[model samples]
Target chain A: MNPALVALFMIGFTIAAYIGSLHLYRKYRRIYTTPVIVATAVIIVFLLLFHVSYETYMIGGKWIDRLLGPAVVALAYPLYQHREILKKMLVPIMTGTTIGAVVGISSGLLLSKWAGFSTEIIHSIVPKSVTTPVAMSISESTGGVMPLTAVFVMIAGIGGMLIHPLVMRYSGLTHRIGRGVGMGSASHAIGTAASMERDTLEGSISTVAMILSAVIVSIIAPGLTLLLL
Target chain B: MFKDKAIIIPIQIAMLYLIYLAGKGIQNLFDLFIPGSVIGLLILFTLLSLKLVPEWILQQGVSFMVRHLPFFFIPATVGIISYAYVFKGKGMLLIVIGLFSTALVMALAGRVTQWMVKRREEA
Candidate 1:
């Protein structure tokens, strides 16, 4: 297949998946558990069984991934539109993100060492709390594979999404501000999406926290990795 | 929905190309410094915050991308296939440690943040 043709097909498939998932989400109103997960699993399984190389897939997929940065920036408009509420909660949001980023990196390093993981793996895992791009960069700078960091970050996001509600219930943490910051800090973009589905205020707060955590982690991870390792 | 739909598609394509150009420009500038995508996002955020680009233009493109963002990761995920042999040894131990420790830290971070917020609220 021509690379251009493959790219077109992949874009078509991606758009179709998005539309289908949106439909299912609207019907089910359970954004986290349904369409996206099912679509991702099915497509991934198909790709794997067919022996599609990631590079080949990415010949098309990179076009989509290229937009991730701008998309993140686009999040600001919705955030800006809701600036009044955001202004009110800025203190809690900033404080929560700072605390979350610190604890996340510290505990990850500590626990991985305790579990007998090597320094490289520990370095990779510690930044999983940040968004993927930042985590991958941090991992690379600290002598970990960018690809491996990507995987760990995705897994962290999925894990945070799956378990957060249950954790919230168990811990009796119900305030939207607390929940939003915790979700954003722990899960990055995925958790931000989950919070958005819950409410606009929650989503905006989570977006702010998520971005702050990523920036903070990027700055702090490299220095900390040197000291700890 | 249909009226907006028609406009959204073209606008999204245009915005995506513009973002691509912006990203490339950023990458070029930062290639001498750091990686470009990080700088590109920062630049984009700055632009958006400054209202240099209209929100509506970027919003559709962003919405389109975010909705299907996971699919973009499929290629990266499949890279694990080539590493299966490499992963057979100590790699397994590393992955186990990595996944669980990352999760544990994430949970701890969430809990600690919540605690700090609670303490602040009480004060």
Candidate 2:
């Protein structure tokens, strides 16, 4: 097949999946409705059914990857919008986000090691808490598998977003800020989306938390990987 | 918001690429653990401090992007098809570890923030 044709398939598949996922979310309004999950499912099946090589998909898929930086930078809008709330909750948000980022990385490192995974796998697991782009960068810096790190991030993001309501309901953790900060710090962007489902305040706060955690974790992940991993 | 601001996407993309290059330059020079995009983020965020981009431009750009944020990640997510074999055996274990660590982070971070806020209220 022509390379351009392959790229078109990749692009068409992604756009269609995203549109379908958006419609599903509009109707269902659940985490399962998220475009990430739906697109992932559709793309996987599309690949298998068509027998397309991952490399061919990546030819155009990499265009999306390149946008990640700008996408991340775009997130600054919400962070900027939430500036006042950030100022108000600076102390606790910082302390809590930092603690969460550290615990998230350390636990991933320790657990992967305890589970008897290889050192390389463990490195991939270490930055599971941060956002995807940043986590991939950390993974590469520390010699972790790039693709694996992205998988781990989506897993962690989806898990945290889904599990938080249950955690709040059962654990008696009811504070709005508590929930938002926890989800954002632990889960990053997807978690922020989940937080947004509740109200604007939680959403904005979560966005800020995810932003702060991205910067903080990126700074510290290398050191943490060294001392602990 | 979409009418006039839609034009800003090109400008935003240009800014994003420039910021990325700045980050990439710093990255190559120093061998930092962070990615160029992140340093791009830092530069962008600090640039945010300067208030150069109009508020509507920033807001509209972000909102449009955020709505379709997951679209941008489909490639990376689907790229996992390449590494399916890596998780062939230990897939369950890796995912379990991932979930457990996430749960712990949520639990600890939430509890700590709640406790600190309560203490402040008491004070």
Candidate 3:
């Protein structure tokens, strides 16, 4: 297949998949229905069935990936939009994110070790609670595979999406701030999506937690990795 | 949404691209470890706060992009197939521990923050 055709197909396939998955997610309301998760699954199946190389798919796939940076920058609009509520609870929100980062790293380190994974895998697991872009860099610097870190981040995220309500109900961690913080800090974007489903304020708060936790964890991940490992 | 406002999106993307470029430049110059997009976010926030970049200009575009931010991550997630071998051995074990720890982080950190908020109210 020609490179240009491959690129066009890749782009068309993803856009089509994204819209289709968006509908499926809204209708089916399942984790597998998540636009990103579903789109990836569909594309992977397409690649395998068609015998296309990942490299060829990446021709235009990379273009889609390139949008992440701008997408991230776009996040500031919401944070700014909710500036008033954030200002009132600024200190508590920061406190929640900071404490969440500490717990996330220490627990990730200890649990991975206790489970008998290698040091490298353990390192990757440490940043599992942080957002993907930040987690990828931390994982690479700390001797973990970047791709593996992405996987772990997704698992943690999807895990939060599934279990957060359970944790909130049974654990008595039901404060709205706590819910937002927990979801944002632990699950990042996936959890934020769940929070958005609940309320705009909840979603905004989760956004704050997600951004703050990423910054905090990235700053402390290396130093703590040195201390703990 | 961009039907008649086609120019808004292109302009918004261009401005965001410029902000992102400035962010990348700063990251390279300062040798920072943080993601350039984050710095770009801060820059956009500052510009908005200062009234330098009119909020209305970027409002619809940015919000639309942010709403579908998850879509931007699909390619990277699919790239996970590249690391399929890592899951062959104790990889499942590692994932279990990772997931368990993520749960703990949420429960514990959230509780701690709630405690602090209660303390502040009490005082």
Candidate 4:
């Protein structure tokens, strides 16, 4: 009956479920089994079955959410590791990221508008291309639902991975740097991880693009959303 | 070796948390539009680049966090439980928007970068 005990249970359950999901993903190597989706699904199912409310779940969930900030800050270490390549290819990376960032925001807004979604949903979709923590914060500041933003971001990442081959083959994206830029700028962390699996150079370059895209999207999403939506 | 890790990893994580807090404080004081975490990321990147903070100090803890980064997002993603009504009747539309926009951005950004990189090589 103690609240703290329930909170601890929820936290432990989440970690246990995640470790299991991670194992499944490593074994199966399927998109559907991606640990984030699998772990979230299992936890949601458990809560619904037990009649636990989202608010109660958050007593523990919020603690995990709190670490998201430091995890984001840790992204800097990878960027620092690849600083030399970053410096050498700064111009092209910036150009590609700026273009990708603008298109990503505008196109999402235009499409969401055409679909007749509310402004709040539009705001969520606007930052869907950036990294999760950054996107969630942007969504919060812009009057969007943070959870929906995360879902939209997940969808974007998976979509990018699925269609990347077709896009790369037809678009003549041969260079590792270009491939990395496209994946990171458009798909964020999920894409970067997938790119890492495919090629180390691309994976590293995607790291740069992912971080830069986050910075650029955070700066631009507010003003751009105001203009479009 | 095990004892050293036991001491260092926590300290490194603590240092990261301190930077994150400082970033939040700066954001509040300056009225910046950027999120505190991102501000923290930039600060850490600057510190790493300037060699003010040695890489070895934060390397293990940072790598551990980065490796399991997706784990942190699970809780937030599960918050979708409360917003199911908002997404009803809009699932197909959102999927279409995500797929279409992602593909477009990838192609265009890739093409532009490829062109620029090729031009540089030719020059």
Cα TM-score per model: 0.80, 0.86, 0.91, 0.86
Could you give candidate 3's per-residue lDDT for residues B1-123 as a string of tens digits? Answer: 455567788688777878888888898899887778878988998888788887888887786787777777777767767676777777767667767787887888788767776777688
* Residue range A121-176, candidate 3, lDDT tens digits: 88888888877878998898889877778888978887777777778877698777
Lowest-lDDT window of 10 residues in candidate 2 chain A?
A72-81
TM-score pick, better of 1 and 3: 3
Order of models, best DockQ first: 3, 4, 2, 1
Off by over 4 Å in 2: A140-143, A196-200, A214-229, B1-13, B118-123
Question: Top TM-score: which candidate number?
Answer: 3
Residue A7 of model 1: what lDDT?
Answer: 89
Specify the highest-DockQ model's number.
Answer: 3
Cand. 1 Cα-lDDT: 0.67
Tell me the deviation in Å of residue B8 in model 4. Answer: 3.0
Please provide, for model 2 over A1-229, each residue's C-alpha lDDT reduced to its tens digit, 9 standing for 90 to 100: 7888877877887888889888898899876667777878888898889887788789878877888777666666666666776687778877888898899989999888888899989988888888886888888888998878988888788788767777777656677777878888888877876676566567766766786787788888889888986
CA lDDT of A11 in candidate 1? 66
Chain A only: list TM-scores of all candidates: 0.91, 0.85, 0.88, 0.80
User: Which residue pairs come into collision in candidate 3?
Assistant: none
Global lDDT scores for all candidate models: 0.67, 0.77, 0.81, 0.85
Which portions of model 3 show Cα errors greater than 4 Å?
B1-3, B115-123
Q: Between candidates 3 and 4, name the one with more favorable TM-score.
A: 3
The residue-by-residue lDDT of candidate 4 on B1-123, one tens digit each, is 335877888788888999999888998999776668878988999998899998888889998877787788777778778867755676677888888999889988878988898898789
DockQ of each: 0.33, 0.56, 0.65, 0.64
lDDT of 3 at A88: 75
Q: Which candidate model has the greater lDDT, 1 or 3?
A: 3
Give the distance in Å from residue A72's predicted Cα in candidate 1 to where it truly belongs: 1.3
